[model samples]
Target: MGGAFLAAAVLARLGGRIGLPTIPLFILAGILLGPHTPGVVLLSDPHDLEMLSALGLVLLLFYLGLEFHIDDLKAGGRKMAVAGGTYLALNVGAGLGFGFALGWGTSEALVLAGVLGISSSAIVTKVLVDTGRLGNPETKPILGIIVVEDIFLALYLAALQPILSGADSLSAAVMDGGKAFGFLLLLALAARFGTRVVGKLFNTKDDELLVISFLGAAVFVAGVSEWFGVADAIGAFMVGLMLGSTSSGARILKLVHPLRDAFGAIFFFGFGLSIDPGDLPSVVWPVLAAVAVTLVMNVLAGLGAARVYGFGAGPAANIATTLLARGEFALILATMAAGAGLDERLSPFIAGYVLVLAVLGPLAAGRSAWLARVLPGGAGVCAGRGAGRGGGLTFRRRVRVRGGWSRSSPRPWVVVRLRAGGRFSRSSPRP
Candidate 1:
C-alpha cells in the first residue's frame, strides 16, 4: 500500500510538470509496478487494493455529488436529458453495431454495448478538476450526462445480469430491471425530500465527527445500492446530493478534497494492477477500431450538445474530449463477461480499449483548442450570448494610448471567459 501511494504520487508529480493529466499517470504507475511488468513488482495481486479502490470510487462520486447542485439539475433538466440521451443513443447504438459486426455471441454483444457506451465517471470528474473546468458552463451538461448514464447503468446492469445468468425467461430480466428502477426512484425521493432529515443527522460542529458521519453514510449506502442491483457509485452520488443540500455542504466539500484525491489515485492504480500487458495484443485491432468509433461518436455528441445549449466550438470540443475515457464500468462489464463464460476475447478487447482512451482522453481534453479550430465554427466563436452562460476565446488588440501606444503585453490576443457570471476572466492565448 505504501509503495502504491509513493509510486502513484511520484509518477503523477512528474507528469504534472509535463502538462499531463494525473489519471493515466497513476494508472501507468500501477502497470509498471504491478505483477504484469518485469521490474519492481510491488503487488502481485490487484485484489489487494480492491477495497481501497472501491473506497476511492465512492469518494470520487460523493465529491462530484457534493459539487453538483440540485438547482442546476432543475434548470437544465430538459437540456441535460437531451444531451445525455443523444450521447447514449449514439454511443450505445454504435457499440451494439460494432459488437454484432464482430460475430460474437449475443451475450458478448450485450456486454460490449455497455463497455463501449458508458464513460468513466471517475475519469471524467478528475479531468474537469485537473483542467480547471469544473466551473465551466459545459460542465453542467457533462455532469448531467453522467447522471443520466448512471441511471441507465442501473437498468442496463439489471437486464444484463439475467441474460448472463442464462435465465430461461425474459420475465426475470424485466423483474430485475423494475427492481433497480424502483430503487432509484426511492433514492431520488430521499434526495428530494429527505435533505432536512439527513442534514440534521450529519450536522455536527466537529470536523472529525462530520467526516466520519458522511464517510460512513456514503460507503454504507453504496454497499446497500449494490445489493439492490444499482451501481455503488450512484448510491454514493445520491448521498452526496442529499448532503450537498444541507448547510454544512461547503465545509464537507472542503474537508473531503484530500480524501477524494488520495483514494481516487488508488482506484486508478488498482485498475492498472489488474491488466496484463500480454493480453492486449490479440485484441489490438478490435480495440483500435472501438477507440475510433468512440472518438467519432463523442465528437458528434459534443456538437449536438453545443447546438442544444447554444455553445461554441471550444466548449463543444471540451465536452467531447473530456468525456472520452472508459474505465471502471468497462472493467466491471469485462469481469461479468469472464464469469458468464462469454467469448474469451472480450476481456482483452475491453482492457486495451480502456487503456488507450484513458490515456488519450485527458491529453485531448487539455488540448481541445486544436479540435475547436477544426470544428465548424472557428475557435473565435462567442461561447455564450450572456456573460455567465458560457465562455470562449476572446481576442484583444493593442490599443494606442496617451503614451504613444501602450506596449502590447505578451500573449495579449486571447483570454478565457470564466463562468463567474463573466465577472472574472483569464488570458490563455497559447494553443
Candidate 2:
C-alpha cells in the first residue's frame, strides 16, 4: 500500500503536467499494476485494499459535506429550488431518454438515467479546489446543487432498488426509501442542533481525540447508512455536515485533510483494480458516445441552471465546467447493477465513460478562461480574491510600484499582489 501511494504521487505530478485529473492517473496507475495486467506489482490480497478504498469513499464524501452548512440549504431560497429542480429534470430526462433510445429495458434504462442524473460531488469538489474556484461567487450555488443531488440519490435509489432487485413488494421499496429520507432528516436536525453534542464528544485541544472521534463517527454513521439501505457515502457525509455546524469543525477539517487525501488516492486506485483492460476495446465506442452526450448535457444543464439563479457569464461557465466531472456515485451505481446481474456490458460502459469524463472534466474546469472567451461578455470575466476593502485582482496591467525612500516623490507606491490560477492573490487598487 505504501509503495502504491508513492507511485500515485509521482503519477499525480505527471497528470498535472499533462493537464489531467489526479484521480484518473491514480486509477490508471492501479490498472497498470493490478492483477489483470501482466505479472506486475499486484497486491497479494485485494480485499484489504478494497476496504481501504471504501474508507476513502467515506472520507471523500465526509470532506465534501464539511464544506457546507445545513443553514446554506435552508436559506437557499426559491432560486436554489428552481435551479436545482431544472438541473435535475434536464439531466434525468436526457439520461432516461437516451437509455430508452438505445433499446434498454425499464430497469436498465432507470439505472442508466440515475447514473447520468447526478454528477460526482467528490470529483466536482476536487475540481473546485484544483481550479481555485472554491471562493468564486458561483461556488455557493454549486455546493447547494450537490447537496440537493445527494438528497435525490436517496429518493431515487429507494424508488428504483426494488424494481431492479425484483424485491417482493412496493411497501418494501417504500420502507427502504423512508429509511433513507428519515436518515437524512435525522442528520439535518443534528446539523442544526448537534453542536453541543459534538463539543462534549470531541475536544478541540486534543488533536488525537479529535481525529479519532471524527473518523469513528464518520465510519460508524457510514456503516449505519448502508444498513439503512442508503449509500455509505451518505452516512459519512452526514457526520461531516453535522460537524461543519460546530465551532471546532474547521479544526477537525484541518486535522483530517492529510488522511482524506491519502485514503482518497487509494480509493481511486482500487477503482482501477476493478476495471479489465480486455473490456476497453469492446466498450470504446459506447464510452465515446456516452462521453459526447454527457459533455453536451452537462455544460448545458450547468449553464442553464446557473443562469436561472441570476448568475452572470463567468459564474455560469464555472458552474458548467464544475459539473462536468462524473465519478464515485456513477461507479457505485454501475457496481450495484453489475452485482445484481443487470448486464455485463453496462459495467464496462460506465467504467470507460467515467474514465473519460474524470479526465476531461478537470481539464476543462482548470482552463475555463478558454470557455469564457467564447461566451458573451465573458472576455472581462475575472475571479476576485477577498482582500482588505474588497479589492480584486485582474489581468489589466502590472506595475513595479516602489515603496519608500523616493526623494523625488514623497508618496510611495506598493506592490499589491501576484496572480495565481487566473485569479488574483489579493485585490489591489485599480491604477
Candidate 3:
C-alpha cells in the first residue's frame, strides 16, 4: 500500500509535468498495482478504499461550489433549463436504448443509463479551468449546462440506490425525495447561519482546529444524510457549498486543497485498483460501446441545448463538444451499483469507462477553443456585445485611442499614447 501510494504520487506528478490529467495516471498506477497487473500488490481489495474515494468527491465538489453562487443556477434560468432538460432527456434515452439493445436486464439497463447519463463535472471543470477555457464565450453555456446536470445527478444518485436496490418502493422514493429537499433546506439555513458562527469560532490560527472543524462539519452532514438514506457525497458537497458561501470558504479551500488533492489522487488510483483483469475480456466490448454512446450522445445533447438557448451554431457546437466528458457521477453510479449487486457484471466496465473519459475529457476541453475558431463566425461571435467574452477592447476604446484619450479609464495617466499605426504605449508625465 505504501509503495503504491508513492508510485501513484510520482506518476501523477510526472503526468502533470507532461500536461496530462494526473487522474488517469493515478488510475493507471492503481491498475499497475492491482490484481490485473503482474508483480504488484498495493491494494488487496478495492472495496475497502471506496469510501475514502467518495470522501474525496465530497471535497472536490465542495471546492467547486466555492467558485460559483447557488443562485447562479437561477441566473441562467431559462437557457439552462432548456439545455439541461434536453441534455438529460437525450442521454437518459440513449442509455436505456443502448442498454436494452445490448440485452442488459431492466435493473441493469437503468443502471447503465443513469451511469452513462452523468458527466464528470469535476473532470470537465478541471480541464476548462486548467486550459483557461472557463472564460470563453462558449465555455459559459457548456458550464451552465453542467451545473444543471450536476444538480440532477445529485438527486438521481440519492434516489437511485433505493429504486435499483429493490430495497424500497415508490413510497420510499417519495420519502427519499422529501429527505433530499429537507436536507437542502437545512443546508441553506446552515449556509445562511451556521457558517458565520462556525467561521467566528474557528477564526483563530490553530491549523489543527480549523482542519478539525472543517472535517467535522463535513462528516457530520455526511453522516446525517446517510442516516436518511441519502448519498454521503451529496451531503458533503452541500456542506462545502454552504460553507463556501462564507468569507472563510477561501481560506478553507487553500488549507484543504493539498488534502483534497492527495485524497482525490488516491480516489482515482483506487478506482484503477478495483479493476479485475480476469473480467476484462467479457467487459471490454460493452464498456467501449457504453463509452462511445456516452461521449457522442453527451455532445449532441449539449449542442441541442446550445440551439435551444439561442447560441449561434459555432458556439453551440463548441459548448456541446466541450461538455462531452464524464467523471464523479459515473463513479457514484458504480458505487450504488456495487451495493445493489449490480457490480456482479458491470463494475469493471464502469471503472474502465471512467478512466477513458478522464483522459479524453481534458483533451476535448483543451481543444474546444481551436474547434470553436473553425466554426462559422466563431472568432467574431466571441467579440461583440452580449457574447460573454472577457477583456475585448470595444470600438469606443478605438475611437478614444484615435482621439488620444482612453475609452475604458478616465485617468489622464492611463490614456492612450499612440505612436505608430495602431500601436500604443503607456502614457507618462515628463518635462
Candidate 4:
C-alpha cells in the first residue's frame, strides 16, 4: 500500500510537468512497478491493494455525487435521456456488430456490447476536475449522461448474469433485474425524501466524527447495494447525492477532497497492476478497431448532444472527447467473462482497449480546442449563452437611440433570453 502511494505520487508529479493527466500516470506507475514487469516490483499481487482500490473508487463516485445536485438532475432530465440514449445506441450497436464479426459466441458479443457501450464515470469525473471544466456549460450534460449510464448498468449487469451463468431460465434474469432496479429505486427515494433524516444522522460539530459518519454511511450503503446486485460505485454516489442537499454538503465536499484524490490514484494503480503488457499483443488489431469505433461514435454523440443543446463546435468536441474512456466497468466485465468460462480472448481485448482509451481520453479532452478548430462553425458561437437543456437560444436587444447608435455605445445590449419548450420568460420582451 505504501509503495503504491509513493509510486503513484512520483509518476503523477513527473507526468504533471509534461501536462499529462494523473490518471494514466498512476496506472503507468503500477505497471512499471508491478510483478508483470521485470523491474523493482513494489507489489507482486494486485489483490493486495484490492480493498484500498475499492475505497478509492467509492470515494471518487461519492465526490461526484456531492457535486451533482438533485436539482441539476431534475432540470435536464429529458435532454440527459436523449443524449445518453444516443451514446449507448451508437456505441453498443457498433460493439455488438463488431463482436459478432469476430465470430465470438452470442454471450461474447453481449459482453462486448456493454464493454464498449458505457463510459467510465471515474475517469470522466477525474478528467472534468483535472481540466477545470466542472463549471463549463457542457459539463451538466456530461454528468447527466453518466447518471443515465449508471442506471443502465444495473439492468445490463442483471441481464448479463444469466447469460454468463449459462442459465436458460429467463425468469431468473428478470428476478435479478428486478432486485437491482428495486434497490436503485429505494436509494432514489431515500435521496429524494430522506435528506433531512440523513442530515441529522451525520450532524456533528467535530470534523473527525463527521468524517467517520459520512464514510460509514457511504461504504455501508455501497456494500448493501452490491449485495442487491447494483454497482457499489452507484451506491456511494447515491449516498453523496442524499448528503449533498443537506447543510453539511459543503463541509463534506471540503473534507472529502484529499481522501478522494489519494484513494483515486491507488485505484488506478491497482488497475495497472492487474494488467500484463504481454497480453496486449494478441488483441492489438481488435483493440485498435474498437478504439477507432469508440472515437467516431463519441464524436457523433458529442455533435448530436451539442445540436440538442444548441452549442457550437468547441462544446461539442469537449462533450465527445470528455466521455471517451472506458475503465473500471469494462474490467469488471472482463473478470466476469473469465469467471464464467467465456472466450479467453475477451480479457486481453478489454484490457488493451481500456488502456488505450484511458490514456487517450484525457489527452483528447485537454486538446479539444484542436478538434473544435477543425469542426464547423466558430468555437465561441453561443458560448456561455445559457445552461444546458431548455435554454439553447440567445436573444440580443439593441436600444437604438439618437444619432443611429453612436460609436460610444456600439455593441448591442445582450439580454440573453431563454425560450425553452416553446415558453418564453414573462419578463422578456415579446419579440
Candidate 5:
C-alpha cells in the first residue's frame, strides 16, 4: 500500500512537471497498482477512498461557494439566469439524445444526461484563476455564468439521485423534489434569520468563534440536505449563498481556507486511488466518443447561451469555450452511478473523460482570445483594439496617478466655497 501511494505521488509530480494534469495521472496510477492492473492490488475496495473523495467534493464545493458572492449573482442578474438556463437545457438535451441513440436504459440515459448537463466548475474556475483571467473583463462574465450554473448543477444532481437510485417513482420523485424545495425554503428562512442572529451573536467579534460558527453553519446545512436526500454539495452551496449575503463571509472563508485546501488535495488524490486500471481497454472508445461530443457541444452551447445573454460574440465564445471541460462533477456522477447499480464499466470511462477535459479545457480556453479576435466580438471583447495590450494603456495610466493634490491646484469645489464665503479675500483668488 505504501509503495503504491509512493509510486502514485512520484508519477503525479512528474506528470505535473510535464504539463499533464496530475489528477488523471493519479487516477491512472491507482488503476495500474489496483487489483485490475498488472499483478498488484493496492486498493481492494473503493469505499474508504470514496469517503475521502466525498470529503474532497464537500470541501471543493464549500470553497467554490466561498469564492462566490451573492452580490456577483445579483449584479450579473439577467445574464446569469438566461445563460445558465439555456446552457443547462441544451446540454442535457444533447446528452439525452446521445444516450438514447446508444440504447441505454431510461434510468441510465437520464443519469448520463445529468452528467453531461454540467461542466467542471472546479476545472474552469481554476483555469481562469491560473491564467490570471479571473477578473478579466472577458472572464468575469463567464465566471458569473459558471457560478449560476454550479447552483443548477447542484439541483440537477439532487434530482438525479432519486431517479437513478430507483428509490423513487415519478410520484415519489415529485414528492422528493417537493421535499427538497421545502428544505431549501427552510434554509432560506434560516439564512434570513442568520442575517439578524449572526450580527447580534458575534457582536464582540472573536475570530475563532466566528470561524467555528461559519463552518458549523455550512456543515449543518450539508447534513440537513443529506438527511433530506438532497446532495451534500447542494447543502454546501446553500450555506455559501446564505453567508455570502451577510458581511462576514469573506472573513469566514479566509479562516477556513487552509483546512479546505488540505482536505481538497486528499480528495483529488483519493479519486485517483479508485480507478481500476484493468477496465480501461473495454470502455475506451465509448468514453472517448462521449468525452469528445460533450466537449464540443458544451462549448458551443455555452457560447450560444452567452450570446443570448447579450454578451458580444468574443466573450460569449470565450465563456462557452471555457465551460467545455469536466472535473469534480463527473466524479460525482460516477459515484452516483455506482450507488444506483449502473454498470461498473462506466466509472473508468467517466474518470478518463473527466481527466482529459481538465487538461485540455484550459489549453483550449487559453486560446479564447485568439478565438475572440477572429470572431469579431463573439467572445466578449469589452475593450477596443489594443485593449489586450496589457489591459490597454488607460488602466496603467490610472494606476500611475500620484497621491495628494498639488498646492497650486486647489480642489475643484474651492471656487464654490469661495463664492459662498462671498466677496474676496485677495489672498484666496476666486475662479
Candidate 6:
C-alpha cells in the first residue's frame, strides 16, 4: 500500500506536468503497477482494493452531497431546470443508445449511460479556474447543470445496485428499487427541512469532535442506506446534503477536503487494479468512438442548456465546451459493475474510455470558443459580433497582484491570464 501511494504521487505529479487530470493518472498508475503489466509494483487482490475503493466512493459522494443543495432549482429558477433536464436527457440517451448498440443488456446499458452521461466536477472546475473563466457569465449555467446532474445521478445509483445484483427475479429487483427510492425521497425531505434540527443537535466548537461527529454520521447513514438497498454511497451522499445545509457545513467541508483527496486518489487507483492492460486494445476503438460522440454531445448539450437559460451563442458554446470531462461518477459505475460480475468487457471498456476522456475532454474545453464559432450559430465566448473567424477575449491592463498593478515581474508565481486568441495564457501576478 505504501509503495502504491508513493508511485501514485510521483506519477500524478508527472501527469499534472503533461496536463493529464489526476484521477485518470491514478488509474494509469494502478494499471502500470497492476498484475497484467510488467509487475514492477504488485497490485493487491481485486476484492480487497474494491473494499477500500468503496469507502472512497462513500466519502466522495458524501462530500458532494454536503456541497449540493436539494432546493437549488428554486434558486436558479426555470433556467436551471430547463438546462439541466435537456442536458441530461440528451447525454444519457446518447449513452444508453450507444451501450445497447454495443450489445450489452439493459442493466449494462444503464450503467454505461451513467458512466458517459455525467461530467467531472473536479476537472471542469480546474479547466475554468486555469483558463481564468471561473468567474465568467457562462460558468453559472455550467455549475447549475452540474448540480442537476448530481441529483439525478444520486437517484440513478441508488436504484442501480439491485438491478446489477440480480438477487431473486424482476419483482425482487422492483422491490429493491422501491426501497432505494423511498430512502432517497426521505433523505431529500430531511435535506430540505432538517437543517436547523441538525445544526442545533451537532453544535461543537472543538474541531476533533466536529470531524468525528460528521464522519460518524456519514458512515452510519451510509451503512443503514446499504442495509435497506439504497446503497452506501447514496446514503452517504444524503448525509452530506443534510449536513451541508447547516451553519457548520463550511467548516466541515474544509476539514474533510484533505481526506477526500487522499481517499479519492486511492479509489481511482484501485479501479485501475481491476483491469488487465492486455484487454484494452480489444475495446479501444469503441471507447474512442464513445469519447468522440460524448465530446460533441457535451458541446451541443452545453450550448442547448445555456440557450434555454437565455445565454447568447458565445456563452452557449462556452457552456457546451466546458462540460465535457467525465470522472468520479464514471468510475463509480465501473467499480460497481466490476463488483457485480457484469460483462468482463464493461470494466476495461469504461476504464479505457475514462482514461482517454479525462485527458482529451479538457483539451477540447480549451477549443470550445473555436468550436462554437464553427457551429451553426457561429458565435462563442472567445468570438465577437461580426462574421468570419471570431475573436476571443484578451487582457490589456497591466497585471495586478495582491496590492497594486505591476508593469513587470520580479520572480515568478502561478498566474493565469485570458487572451483574445485563446481562452487562457500565462502571465505574472506581480505587485
Could you tell me the lDDT of residue 236 within candidate 5? 79
TM-score list, all predictions: 0.90, 0.86, 0.77, 0.89, 0.74, 0.74
lDDT of 2 by residue, 140-246 (tens): 78877776777788889888878778887989888888888898888777877877787677756888878989999999998988887667887787788788778
Model 5, which residues run further than 4 Å from truth?
Answer: 1-43, 137-168, 188-193, 199-207, 245-247, 335-345, 370-431
Which candidate number would show the highest lDDT if scored against the true structure? Answer: 1
What lDDT tens digits, residue by residue, belong to model 5 across residues 114-156?
A: 6677777556644554444444445546665565565565456
lDDT, model 1: 0.87
Candidate 5 — what's its lDDT?
0.61
Q: Over the stretch 1-431, how does candidate 3's per-residue lDDT look in tens digits?
A: 46667988899788878766566687789888887788867677887687777677666655555555455544676877778788888888898888788775777788878767767765654555455444344555666666567557556756676777676677777777777767766865675566667567657577788788888878778778767655565567667766666667777878888877777777777777876666667678887888788767866775676677665544565565556666666766777777777647777777777777777766665445444454554664332212222222222132333444444555433433321122344444321
Give Cα-based local distance difference scores for all models.
0.87, 0.74, 0.65, 0.86, 0.61, 0.71
RMSD (Cα, Å) of model 1: 6.7
How would you order the candidates by lDDT, starting with the best? Answer: 1, 4, 2, 6, 3, 5
Report the lDDT tens digits of candidate 4 across residue range 1-431: 88888888988889889878888998899899999999799988889999998999999999999988888877888998998888889988998998998988899999999999999988998988887666676888898888788888999999998889989999988998999999999998899889999899888889999999999989999999999999999999999999999989999999999999999999999999988999999999999999999999999999998988777786788899989999999999999999999989999999999999999998887777667666777444354322232334454445344444233465556354443223334344422
**Model 2 local distance difference test score:** 0.74
Among residues 3 or more apart in sequence or in different chains, the pairs in candidate 3 whose N, CA or C atoms overlap within 3 Å are: 120-326, 120-327
Candidate that beats the other on TM-score, 1 or 2, i.e. the better one: 1
Better of 3 and 4 by TM-score: 4
Specify the poorest-scoring 10-residue window by lDDT in model 4: 384-393
Clashing residue pairs, candidate 6?
Answer: 66-240, 302-320, 314-380, 382-391, 382-392, 392-420, 393-419, 393-420, 394-420
Total backbone collisions for each predicted model: 0, 1, 2, 0, 11, 9
Model 1 misplaced stretches (Cα beyond 4 Å): 379-392, 395-416, 419-423, 426-431
